[model samples]
Target: MRLNLQTDYALRTLMMLATHGGQLAVDDIADAYGISRHHLMKVAGRLAELGYVVARRGRGGGLSLARPAEEINVGSVVRDIETLDGFVECFDAGSNGCPVAGVCGLQGALSLAVGDFLARLDRYALTDLIPSRQLFAERLAPTSPSTSPP
Candidate 1:
């Protein structure tokens, strides 16, 4: 099961914010991760819209998690970013071109696997993955930063 780049970036962005706790500029996040500020801004906007993070403007303004790390479920974040739950070609409603689309056990099995994956994620919060925010920051600090959109 592979997550798309958008989802991957969303997760990374969330992890970064989760670790920061305090306010962080979008530029700092992009720079820290060596990712495109434009893409990260889009991700940040989605996160803000979903109530996962909040954004503020001004000299000290930046972004931060809306809730405590312990309250934010990792599974919920992934679900918000993931457009489809389909694991196999037959599972997609738009393109079920497989010859055995209607009678395939593969589709059912894959669905089960995807469900299990999400279920496991549901059991964890961002804090569960990283014990210390400082540690997380230290681990991610080596990456380059990018310029965020104003």
Candidate 2:
């Protein structure tokens, strides 16, 4: 049940944005998270495409969440970034090489596990991660100049 690095980065970037509640540059996010801008750019592009975030250009432009933190569901974010959730080769739709694939209890158990994972995420919103908006605002204020809008 390991998420890909892309999905990990996407979540991290989203959390940072949620905490900041302001426009954030790709480079700043990369630096803060100690990730590559190249990698973050791909994640950012996907986020923007999915309407999770908005990208702006020019001197006063950067990126910000398309909707408020409270409006975005954590489960939706995970589902959007995940390409596949197969825990075993037989679980994959395109390749079920296992001879007992159709009757295996393992597949059902794994499916339940995945469902539980998503269900837990469904209980949370992006705002749930921040806990305190004032604390996040204070933390971002110091890094504001580097990651600020524009």
Candidate 3:
């Protein structure tokens, strides 16, 4: 199963925040990942709304994780950010237009698969994704000497 760009960005953003363990600007994240700042902003906004992140505006303000890295579950984050209903065309009854909608076993199998996928992800936390925090921080902010792992 493939994750949509929004979910991918959300996971990456969490990883970055966990690695830094400090406030990070949306622009900085965008620059590091070579992603769109606007897209990251929307992701960050959603993360803030969901209580996974804390966003502060104005000078000396930026984005930071609301809780410690170990407290943030990867599966929880994905579930919060993803629309699992659309994993397969037949998963959504109201909008499904597939010809074999009810007669096929694909939908049921896929549903179980999705559940297993999430269950496996539940075993990991944000900290688990970055085994070497210092290395990640260095690679993420190559030229920025001020950035370091906490």
> Per-residue lDDT for 1-150 in model 3, tens only?
788889999999999989887999998899989899999999999999999999999898889999999999999999999999898789888989999888989999999999999999999999999999988887877455565545
Model 1 worst lDDT run, 10 consecutive residues: 141-150
How big is the positional error of residue 35 in model 2, measured in Å on the Cα after superposition? Answer: 0.8
TM-score of each: 0.85, 0.85, 0.92
Return whichever of 2 and 3 wins on lDDT: 3
Model 3 regions more than 4 Å off: 144-150
Q: What C-alpha lDDT values do all the predictions have?
A: 0.83, 0.84, 0.92
Cα RMSD of all models vs. native, in order, equals 5.3, 4.7, 3.8
lDDT of 1: 0.83
In model 3, residue pairs whose N, Cα or C atoms come closer than 3 Å (at least 3 residues apart or on different chains), thus clashing, are: none
Position 142, candidate 2: lDDT: 42
The superposed Cα distance between candidate 1 and the true structure at residue 59, in angstroms, equals: 3.8
Show how many residue pairs clash in every candidate, following the order shown.
3, 1, 0
Tell me the lDDT of model 1 at 50. Answer: 93
